[model samples]
Target: MPYIPTRYFCLIAALVTLAIAVSARFATNDYFFFAGYVVLQYVVMATAWNILGGYTGYVNFGTAGFFAIGAYSAVVMHKLFEPPLVVSIAVGGVMSGLVGLGMGYLTLRLRGVFFAIATLALAIVLQTLITNWDFVGGSRGVYIIRPANGPFGHPYIQYLFLTMLVLSTIAVCIARAIEHSKLGYGLATIRDDELAAEAAGVPTLKLKLIATVLSGALMGMAGAPLPYYVTYLDPSSGFNLAFAVNSIAMPLIGGTSSWLGPVIGALLLATIQQIATVTISSALNLLIVGVIMVGFVVAAPNGIVGLFERGVRARRRPAKKEAA
Candidate 1:
């Protein structure tokens, strides 16, 4: 594949977004917007998780913690001052980024399962704190009243969908930029072997920290719209394990090696899950995720992208052999 310029990519993305917006404008069902918003939210999140977990091989299980921090931060803003969604989103990203930095500093020294465990512990600790903090609704939860009409005068759900779509685009562009840059190479080295990377003066810790901060901030931004989307926030729902599970699963199921993987995975899985939620039952959502993920793990361990790449390579080999 030829290397495409970021500007060109952005232009293409803009066109695609405009097309989607036009389609949504004609959409008769508000459910379309609601479902699309969730899928796009996962796109942002899975991409964010891939930054640290896939790129840096950190495997953070504290996704829920960072996500809740963003939601709760938005809730606080709503209660105290009621800033615009954009401001709330920015604040949420900053808060989560700071937490990610702190968490990375404290736990980045540990490697492998130890690091993973530490992240799980971090989520648990944060959830416990949030449960006890009554100001943000504590164990009871809080309600957010969304405006009926959005800034553009469409229904608020459509606005949320558009917001998430833009965010997902930004996340993908960021991921692609990182993947093609020196930072990506540095993180890849750390992912492959942190000790070796450190010995070779790769600044493994710094790179990992950067990945963590980026990942957490993106996750937070993705979560910032949750209050408006759900209209209710609680410790239980805010810190749901499904967020962490799906974030990890989507990247793995799609292929962790590239930016496209998470997007593909999130779109496929979230869409399937949404369909299942409507047709079957919401209770079966996790079960569906587990079944599909297991099938992918067993059959295409490298993920759908990897499977496709392998097929392409196999087909190319015959042509090369014939040429020889």
Candidate 2:
């Protein structure tokens, strides 16, 4: 037999562990399954936000706005056309992508704090519109009738978790591609110095819009199953500030420069929150997030990934000295 590399062995071990973890949820009850689903959903959302906010250096405070739009799109499709779950999710992505494209065109003109403020305002405006619209339940909220016996049964939690798992995987792949491609280079240039990027013939505007649309579309997809997951959707819940904060915080704390950063951050923070929600108070979970965010910002602005990289370099230094 051929020699198996350590990397492949590790990969197989990781996948086996994940499979066991997912399977364990089904062996338990619905609550644990749903809790796992929520964490996976946040992972998807955080990864989506990282595309624009982390890679492109654009802090979009309106992620919840896109998320809500996607949820409502799913709801509207379910009501009007009664499409299957797959079609509804596709519609959600399309609607959110179009909105994001328009927003990118409108606000890509602004830079830095100005762009952030614009996106934040966009979220508020969308929430206000949803509040007044009445057709899709308005601000009063929309209740979705849970579908009976999905592929996995009332293990709908498992189904949603699988969906989120796929979405997060896709997000990571997309982010990695962007980080390696010409687009990633252009984005890095734009991040480091926009004027320099433009002088080098990079189409900053186009790249920025592409990042925003891709990011928004992924976020929208993440939110598509949310209505069914929670079985309720309201302006307050759909467009909550927690979405914006979590999306931004995960990437920033984990290391925005790399694709793994947001995923790492999401896993760490979400696990902490879940554990805290059980052992401590839910309010304390948010407090913990806040404290972690502040600590990261002040002490390790480059994030955990950056720290890890520095450590790796430091360790390599001693080896080099020994060799010398």
Find the candidate with the highest TM-score and give its number. 1
In lDDT terms, which candidate is top?
1
What TM-score does candidate 1 reach? 0.98
Query: Candidate 2's residue-wise lDDT over 149-217, tens digit each?
Result: 576565566666667676666667677777777898998888888899999999999999999999999
- Estimate the TM-score of every prediction: 0.98, 0.92
State the lDDT of candidate 1 residue by residue for 1-324, as single tens digits: 688877788788878888988888888899999899989999999999999988889899999899888999899999999898999999999999999999999999999899999999999999999999999998999989999988989888989999999999999999988998899999999989877888888998889889999999999999899999999999999999999999999999999999989999999999999999999998998998899999998999989999999999999999999999
**Which parts of model 2 are misplaced by more than 4 Å?**
1-26, 152-154
**Candidates in order: C-alpha RMSD to true structure:** 0.9, 3.6
Residue 247 error, candidate 1, Å? 0.4
Return the TM-score for candidate 2, rounded to 2 decimals.
Answer: 0.92
Per-model tally of clashing residue pairs: 0, 0
